[model samples]
Target: MTELNLELTKEIELLRLVTVGSVDDGKSTLIGRLLVDTKGAFEDQLLAVRKKKGETKIASAAEIDLAMLTDGLSAEREQGITIDVAYRYFATPKRKFIMADCPGHEQYTRNMVTGASTASAAIILIDARNGVMPQTKRHTHILSLLGMPHLIVAINKMDMVDHDQATFERIRQDITDYCAMQGIKDLICIPMSALNGDMVAVRGENMPWYDGPTLLETFESLPVLGQLDEQAFRFPVQLVNRPQTADLPDYRGFMGTIASGTVKVGDKVMVLPTGKSSTVKEIVMFDGNLDEAFAPQSVTITLTDEIDISRGDMLVRGDSMLEPQKEITANVCWIGDEPLEPRKKYWMKHTTNTLKAMVTDIDFKTDIHSLEHEQSDQLAMNEIGQIQLKLLKPIYADTYANNRATGSFILIDGFTNNTVGAGMII
Candidate 1:
């Protein structure tokens, strides 16, 4: 790519967003509308959707099925319900978007977590006929807990209510009240009909009394969260490169994506656990060496001094105050079929480090409906609870509120080798 082209690509910011709602709340159809209206779908894809018009629930026989665009799985298409997270990419003149279509069924809440974990914003779809449902509240609570910065509530199916402004106002008020209780600071509400493509990508002649940016306009103008580079530096070493070739026998590089902050050549850094210090000698990338690197950039770094470092070790700024810890308290969401067993060992994978850990205590389980904390001895499937954990080996970390990249972890079942739970450090 040319220099100007590369610069232009960088200027078009990429926003990661997740769409969530109750079951049959038009989540899929809204996504389909976005893709189709933006010309993101290809001719072949549109033709396929038209062929499967019979499967559409909201669209009429004369109209094509837009939901099929994201519900790629056969099971999802057959049931007309999202069962897994489907990611789709689209771009406009001013911005680009990576949209994750998350499942809405109660059983698939785990999948929703996976999608929303990295999202900067979320779009919550509520049916116009039905106000805020239990499932909508549950999803909102989870998103709030995840520290989502922005939310867009799209009141869908307005065509069914004859574009009545009264119905839109009622649902909008309920959503606003609920979100305020959840401590969501940034929110936008739009009345849209995904089936008729009104107020989704384009503003149709419906609900003239209600005036706000269209869903597409809101996404294009929404402010993203603070840049990760402004946070503290964290580089968890994922690999160590040592090519014993005659050309460069002494070459040694620590490779990983910078979790946060920035690093430049000659900067002082410390190796974690070992507490050894070194100066950055080089910042190596595929094309060439860079003068500096920042968070989320995958690059190999060579230090001025040879320190004992390997996978699972972290490199931080020399003046950083972070330290390794053996015990931590975290808010955990249990997704396993079996209930959480206290004192039972499970593999905890935090960043690039994996170690044996066990739950020391169960503080309490959260009631999704009422948002109340109730004392509980065990956590069942799709339950959120605070728990204490003891790790066999100490690992450097931070609070999830400070840095999500280093503060979040997954619990793997030792016997089944499946991810049973996800936790955020307190």
Candidate 2:
């Protein structure tokens, strides 16, 4: 195929991925090199970053630190830490990718949560010398808990180990055992030297014994659209678009991003909270009308009848959907500086619905490494536990394993507006 044809074909496949690991395990470097070697980085920009590759460069180490490419914040540059999720976009001949480079510190686990919320797959990096450490276990455990079905374990720094297949096998077995205990079954292990560009964007002769696909090759083989299509339909109204003026008078529409599934014109839909029924009259994107809309696509939807609908309302197919529930049980990861308090109400935002919720009971605390659950009264910062919650009003939700967008929620300090916890609805 011609270059233009190849580019056009690739536009049909889009992948959203996240890279995670312990501090200095080459998570960012792997992403940076992947983007750079794929010709995803601009020449002028890469040259500018390359100019500072020397001993005097205080921002990062000498030897062209690829991690610096994604570490954009001044605060991060000074401290040598990633405090928030940094996103980058790049496309290859076979696919378009949106990469989220998540933070590695235990304190910034919330950042990882934010990134993982949207990722379809995750690349968990581990240094060959370190093998499987506590933080590696923590990252992998969190990935499993968050229900990321596709996982790639890149055992980096193979060069430092003289590319020994025995060493690679040992580390791979360790990770396999760890993840197996956590109930994460789908895993791909690759021995790579991200610094040397070995088996990253291109196949290398150094690993002739390894017949598995390279990183880029693996991406090309994945069914990105299939996974995106597997989700059930969910549309949460962000804002009720209504213009009562003379121009486009009596235009009442529901504007929001489709959380999952597909919606089509003239489809029978049910409005939540009020339980009103209506048909989708039109699906409008900014440019024009659309026949259908799927997950991650933002569009305005007009209904045939003037049924009552408002912000925080949900539109769904009348059949095969869960009813709204006032009481919910969830696996909670406490991210706040203060511990979770019982009987104190916190603001919960699930999809588009915001309501007050109080913790009714604590079931158990989860140990990430051992996959053990111990009964606990409260969850402290960076702790994961199971809790029962009572919401002021019913919210339509799915089990986290079913649909991530509608099943997960965030807890905020009602008075301070600070996000305190991340929860997966069970």
- The C-alpha RMSD in Å for every predicted model, in order, reads 3.5, 3.3
Candidate 2 Cα outliers beyond 4 Å, as residue runs: 1-12, 47-62, 106-108
lDDT per residue for candidate 2 within 291-383, as digits (tens), equals 988877899999999998888888988884668799999999898888897787899999888899999998899876576899877889878
lDDT of each: 0.85, 0.82
Which sections of candidate 1 miss by over 4 Å?
1-11, 51-62, 78-80, 162-170, 207-211, 223-225
Native-to-model Cα distance after best TM-score fit, residue 17 in candidate 2, in Å: 1.4
Which consecutive 10 residues in model 2 have the weakest lDDT in total?
54-63
Q: Native-vs-model 2 lDDT?
A: 0.82
What's the C-alpha lDDT at position 264 in model 1? Answer: 97
lDDT of 1 at 283: 98
